[model samples]
Target chain A: MNPRDEILNRLQQVQRDETLPPPWQSRRDFPELAARFRQALTAVKGEVHQVDSLAAAYDLTNQLLRQMAAEKVVVNDERPLPNLPRLPHITYHQVGQEDETLRAFCASADAGLTSADAALAETGTVILTSGPGKSRLASLLPPVHIALVPITALTTDLFTWAASFNRQLPANLNFISGPSKTADIEQTMAVGVHGPKRFIVILYA
Target chain B: MSNPSSATMSQFRHSATVAIADIQLQGALTGATNKFVNGRITALTELPHANALRDHFKKIRSATLANLAHYLELFEERATTAGSQIHWAQTGQDAVDIVLNIARQHGVKLVTKSKSMVTEEIHLNAALEANGITPVETDLGEWIIQLAGEPPSHIIGPAIHKTRHQVAELFSKEVGRPLPADDIDGLTAEARRLLRTQFLAAGLGISGGNLAIAETGTLVLVTNEGNGRLVTSAPPVHIAIIGIEKICPDWDAAATWLALLARSATGQPMSIYTTAITGPRRANDPDGPEEVHIILLDNGRSQLAGTPYEEILQCIRCGACLNVCPVYKKAGGHAYGSPYSGPIGAVVTPLLFGLEEYAALPQASTLCGACKDACPARIDLPRMLLQLRQDEVAARLLPWRERKAEEFAAFVLGREGRMNFFTKLGRWGQRPFQHDDGLKLPVNVGDGRTLPSLAPKPFRQLWDEGAVE
Candidate 1:
């Protein structure tokens, strides 16, 4: 028998006294989903700001772009992101416009902007998917990452999120709680090791 | 057993003594483990129904393992449907050969890798290097150890044993520029600058999966450093080397298991990034790996099924047991001399490897049951350790002196008359080695252990005199 057959055969020979585990139910109740989300996000050194409207969020993005002295940013060619006004000084490129340029931009880009599919309140996590316009690297490969989330996207936790998760999923889905960090060096917490250092979530109605 | 393994018991004793004596290593080990233990407590206690979740998760792991082959077949079908090619390796050599063949076919010269204990166990980097491929470990801790020409000391924090001054020196050598010892942020920046190019330029990327979900045929990769994302996405071709036992039946089981994993390991509600990769990049997808290969490695894992050691297969590599282990805290990770360390390592290593060679590891623990308490899956590590020790003794791995001593102890302890005689004998014999609290005997029970001196009067004598009323 080949390796697969042999391995599977060995495992199959074992007598199983198995009981199916109970299905997970969401008993976690967050009184204020958005407030708890902000607190959890902020605790991990991520920034969260609540804006009244999408237009105000765009305005805040512009202000943040200027404040951070960002010269170039990469954004997913998706809704809300495409609505951001074009600024002359700060060049914004749609991720995956050109494969070569996308890689280069991710290498040199100062910030990445995309809209999260869902946000979990308990851990302050954002769910991002990989699809036609949503490049996996858009939220990765930058010093700073800015996410646009709506108030309605907030869920209780991962268990709650998975309970209602769509059966037809994307090629990739990421549950990111905070900025990329590491405590590898002498157990010292160092932020922004690989991905974005500063994760800013702009929540709008 | 190899020549190196012949002296396993003595080697463990020697290395443990050295590790305990090294003040710097002792400080790093205790400091890191205490922080992890404290964080795990805080994270688990804060969550609602945390204990219930753990119990449910344990059932999930057990059920999944009981039907592992079935779930693996299911995962293969779904992953294949999602555009991933699944390969099974019966041994570490088979896994390494398959990976080399993939790298060869791709003509891959530079390979970027996320930190993976499975890869470490198989010695993938050595194979890649021998085949003229440069493998770069992207995780900071893994990279530090890779640069230092040492194996990972800890499974989670590979470089936890290294001090900042030591890391700075390694960084300085790598970059050919002196970096400040105290500035960790600056060092991290240098690593980013260094590894970013590797991720972009590398032709192939290799990673280890935390779990292979049979529900969607998804591979779950969890990391706090975001290296998993880059490794899987940056390179054109991706390969994930997962152990056969690392599986969850479906999304529901996976979700519950994950809830406990992060808390048990890092005390975070979630790691920075928890990615579920179904397949290679879709046709319209903007950016992801074009080809994804999943290698399911058995390598002695399947043999443990239905055996006394089957519970060890449920380990998630969370390193929780290491944090709370008293032996691990003092001896540190390097003393174990394997990919795994601490309480879990003692059982898993010997079971995966041979008990005769790693017999000493089973004796490394104090059988304090801290590991079982800290375990997310609630694996009975202490019970398994005792089993392995029994197997070792059965195989006559114990030295003649030790075996004879044990036999003599059994003879005396089994009979009341003999026990009384031996208690008096021990009391008289222990006088020279006796200290304030216990006996300071020259003999080592495994490592760094002390025996409490015998009582002034045996229980039999005290009872007869009515002193124990």
Candidate 2:
């Protein structure tokens, strides 16, 4: 009778109340967390850019990779764009170099910088996570993603980022929030189907 | 898993009378349920307390279904201590033989799914194409109803009854030429270059859990076409299945059920990927899925736990009661033929299939109450569609002349002088079926619909001339 003990003995003959209720807090307050994360990440087309430091978020990530005429980007090496200023026809590809052609260079890259680990401002979202040198396909398969964040990593939603998790949790986290849409046609929307169609972020401060 | 004779009642009244004489399935079910009821009423009126977060997500789904076997044994012991591999099934052919024996012990030819109404309620792509394996469906409206083999008329727009010239004639017969049917961005860039090489050459990805949590065993998913993050991160074996009533109980009830599931389905305060996962890929993770596997199933949902339709297991499939269903806006979603259609598939496909094959899905609803006011977990669902029409007339399952006209109208409405002698013999037997004032009867009944007439002067003859004290 082991279908997991016949469904835990039919949920222990209908569990009466093993007491659980008491976690849902969110009254939802924002007090301008980066102006409500740039108005919920510019109403989901994303592209925030606030910048006040990290060298003006590395000069708006090299002016949004020369306005997306990108060459071959990639990035995510967990915080190290140091003395940056290269741009001799793009080509970056960082993420801790364990490389086996880093998933076909983040699937034929055209963009995919990174750095966020939190930032919700009531659903503009951007958590990320995945571990060591990041790279969940460098913010997923790239058509343009960017990220950078750190305005003390926002958070006023997804229940204050699952009440700021704990005991070391990263093994694929994500959240994301824009660019890679699809109204499943006839409902219309259509942006990059698989992932990034350009998300950007660069909050800084 | 063959059940699909479109859940009978003469194929739901011949597909609800050909979906009410199809004016393009009533303008694609009134423009996709009026754009998901005006984007779930502008994302729940810009969400601040949104009805106290749907009454705290209906008290976190009725306290996670009353300790659902201690949160599914703490989600199979923290998903087997965060490495995954859980299993369990118990029907729907033991969850399609535990995902076809984990795709025949990982030799899995091609899998790639994602956009799973519990794998279309366990048909599991016709048992993985009758064990030959192939699957595919990478979301763009379940790959336009899996290249038009059909089924999936709409539980989240599964080809919202196909049109864009029938999805450019089912994607020009899956790319063998002739494509442009008003090019929706050239048909989503030819379905993103054919599902990005079937998410980088599938080897098993499956997917289907929208919320499973049990304090960090995790699972989540959501999506908006990153094909649930390339079917849980580009396959190397993933699995998922789900539905032991989507357990919750932690991470603050999976953050109030992901803040009312993409603002009650597609209003999108979220869903452009939510992901989550929590196991199988931890060794300094670079990518994910190094064999995850979840399953859990329990096909009829463990006989719906302390029943009273256990709040229809607090559904979070979030089609928002098929966008405020007026009988799913004129019998659409393929006329509730079931992989869940409107009004929680008319009280969950007749309580998980049977009440004599979905007794015309609780008589296809009209009890209104707009699906418990577009349920976030409000779920009365017209009191479970009047307790499944009193369990389909205590299982006599109607029609003996509609149970003798509902037992002679409940014995003349339980007698007040036989309800005023059948209301003065239905006003003298409907005065020879009055014509211009309305009841043009002579047996056409309701095909053309008029039957109104009975009020002409009989409020008991204007309350015996007191007219209306």
Clashes of 2: 0
* Clash count of each predicted structure: 0, 0
Q: C-alpha displacement of A42 in model 2, angstroms?
A: 12
| Global lDDT of model 2 | 0.81
- lDDT, candidate 1, A1-205, per-residue tens: 9999999888889948787766899788989999999999999999999999999999999899999999989999877888899778988878657766787787789999999999999999999999988888879998899999998999998788888987577889999999999999888899999999999999999
What tens-digit string does per-residue lDDT give for candidate 1 at B1-469? 0113222788888888888889999999988999999999999998998888888888888898899889999999999999999999999999999999999999999999999999988889989999999999999999998989888878889989899999999999999999999999999999998998899999999999999999899999999999999999989999999999998888888888888889999898889999999999998898899999999999899999999899999999999999999999998887787888899889988888777777689989899999999999999999998898888889998888989999888898898888877777878888999888688888775456778888887687789899997
Looking at model 1, what is the TM-score of chain A? 0.96
Model 2 agreement with the true structure over B1-469: per-residue lDDT tens digits: 1226455567788777877888987888788889988998899998887887787788778877887888899988987798888988887788888889888988888988988888888788888888898998888888887777777866788787677888988888889898988878788888888888888888888888888887778788888878888878778889888888888877867888888888888888888888888888877666777888898888787798888998898888888888778777777787677778887888887787777777888777778687888788888988888888888888888767778888999999997899887888898898887888688876666576888887757686699899888
The candidate that achieves the highest DockQ relative to the unseen native structure:
1
What DockQ does each prediction reach against the true complex? 0.82, 0.27
* Residue B232 CA displacement from its true place in model 1, Å: 0.4
lDDT of 2 by residue, A1-205 (tens): 7888988898789878646567767787778888987888788778787878888788779887997689998887786353556588988877767655777888899888888878888888888888766778878787888888888888788777777778366667888887888897778887888888878888887
Interface Cα RMSD per model, in Å?
A: 1.2, 16.3
